[model samples]
Target: MKKKIISLFIILTCLFSSFPFILAAQNLKLVSNYALEDPRNLFYLDNNVYVADGTNGLKIVNVGDPNNPQDQGSYSVSGVCFDVFVAGDYAYLANGITGLQILDVSNPLLIDEMGSVVDSNYAWGVYVVDDYAYMADSDDGLEIIDVSDRENPVEVAESSSGGYAEDVFVLDGYAYLAEKSQGMRIVNVTTPTSPTSLGVFNDGSDIYGVFVEGDYAYLAAHGSGLIVVDISDKNSPSKVTNIAFDGMAREIFVENKIAYVAARSEGLILVNCTDLDTDLTVMAKLDDNSETGSGDAGVYVADNYAYVVDQEKNSLQVIDLTASGGGNIWLWILIPAILAVVVLIVRKSTAKKEPSRKEKLSDEEVEEESNEDGEESAVVGIEESESEKEEIELKSIPEEAEDSQEKSEESEQSE
Candidate 1:
């Protein structure tokens, strides 16, 4: 009994001493990181971070400062990209058109486009698990790529077999695909050279993005909404629960109990993915400066600031998640401010949803001529006098009109 007591005392002392180290690791705060241009997606590779800057190419920033980060410059890439993922020393770009590209980002200061494999079409998202790359190739479907050889990425398999595969997540030798129509699919990549479909969970709507953590997968379903799935059984993945959103969801990021989502025009929406039976609580949402379509883009949070990519604004909007107010006055003003912002956003979108022909037309448009009879009819709907009514034909004429006329005649001839 004496010996057992001594052993227990020693073990307890060691455990108690180690508590500080665990607390230090968990006490991480948002380091120095800021936002930049149409930043579409992000992937943290070691100390260096890479971003897909929509039409502006790929931006690599040195996040040596968790707060004030340094810009590592960008590599010129064609097409409007959506997402990026980094593994090993290479950064994989979902180039939208050129498919999945492998860049030599081994040196954070200097990045070179080593090479790339263009998917049958544009690939939206990419995930490298083991040595294989699973790409959510738009239209062409889910493309299986082998990135074992950085210089040469070969396509092993693909299946347009699912809806629009928008995003992909790979782990434990399996790839979880966010298939727009078919929901999510589990493809086993144990055999890196050749991956085979193991199971699929149809979220019953267009799933735009997915993230797998532990035994479950969180998805951002565009129409039907967000879904959680149990992936313990690879052969039969089951839907654990689903939380519907009032707006279109474009992407999702799961960090512990919190699920961050980019809900298009609705801006950056935060959801609590911890409880399946309860409605997702919107922790916070950063409003985009420009009101864009519901398909605008996505958002990412690092440090304590929310970094959002507003495609319509063509810029990255940064929001601080800090309680700097130090008082409850912020909470009181927040609701009304957010409501006002929402109302203004809705009004602006409504104004843009249907612009008058004059507003849509260009400056070069011809000043219409009055056709007395048609004008009389057109205005008659407004109960106007026949003489006051007028009709007009709007058409532009240029010095190269003859050439345009010839092209129109040729098209008519072909018809």
Candidate 2:
């Protein structure tokens, strides 16, 4: 019985400790949404979100209060804004035909362009590092710019990829570009002046977005879904695996080993990418656009919230990524754990106690019976001793009588 209680306690501890995270996977809820016009991509920083609102240019929303997001500022550019990246007090935008445009967003409400440069090709996506900005210039491939002087930004060099460049993610001196028909192109950007193509992985999928973390590059492969590539060997990157879904995978954002995808018709999908070799499981999904028929086009995750851009709806949806039931789930786990502890304690207390009252009474009864038998034996011995004394006395009296008789006969003879 004690062993069973201990085993139950061990089981409950393990189960309760992991219960919250398991439930958290399916607890993504749509909290609030803010209106926008053709919002394309977004970047989260501090407590604000900078969005590339198509023809509306750059729009900044303060998400400090996720339940009630307010528009903080807006910037209207001459060209369509497809992507925006925020660094320090300035905003870098990939303004289609207008090319690379830098804005002084120190004052979100009154954002003003500090510099502007038009590339020979269209700027589809932009990534900023240090004093440089890497642009994915459609057919123009990769365009490197020097932004050391925000007032006079200049294109340092350009590398023409074989296919259309849709998105770019730079890490460890390599730029991983997602080319529409060419899969992914790995470029050695150690020297920004002249970046040469190191290798390419072409799976014939329409790759739209790329995000590199650690040693792998995650690609948003349109109809094919999310594709993982092993880039440990920069020159020869290989495909690790691909997770397929129904809708088009437009964009991807990864944080803390989880990939948040902007799946067009499928809404927002979260994939667990902690273990690439064995577990590429879809942990949760949110498809609340059934009525609108529009799908999610862009996603950015930070502080347990997902900010998604709904294409047709033209709105930014704020999703609460925290597990449901609030703080009550802890109570559920605590109840079971507390019960297991009670069982263990009760079993231990029982083991240290004496025998039952009935058993103790029976022992007392047997001892009383043995004491009565000893008293009876002592009484019988006393009675026998008295009877023997009386018999001896009677024998002595008879002997005296015989002696007296003999003495009287002797006297008579002498007379």
My TM-score estimates for the predictions, one after another, are 0.64, 0.76
lDDT of 2 at 372: 84
lDDT of 1 by residue, 323-405 (tens): 34122212322344545755564454445346777676566552342355567777785665433343211122353687898
- Give the TM-score comparing model 2 with the true structure, all chains together: 0.76
Query: Which tens-of-lDDT digit does each residue in 291-405 have in candidate 2?
Result: 3335788899887788998877788999877656343212322444566776776666456557675556676776886788789889999989999999999999999999999
Against the reference, the lDDT scores of all candidates come to 0.69, 0.85
Best by lDDT: 2
Candidate 1 TM-score, C-alpha based:
0.64
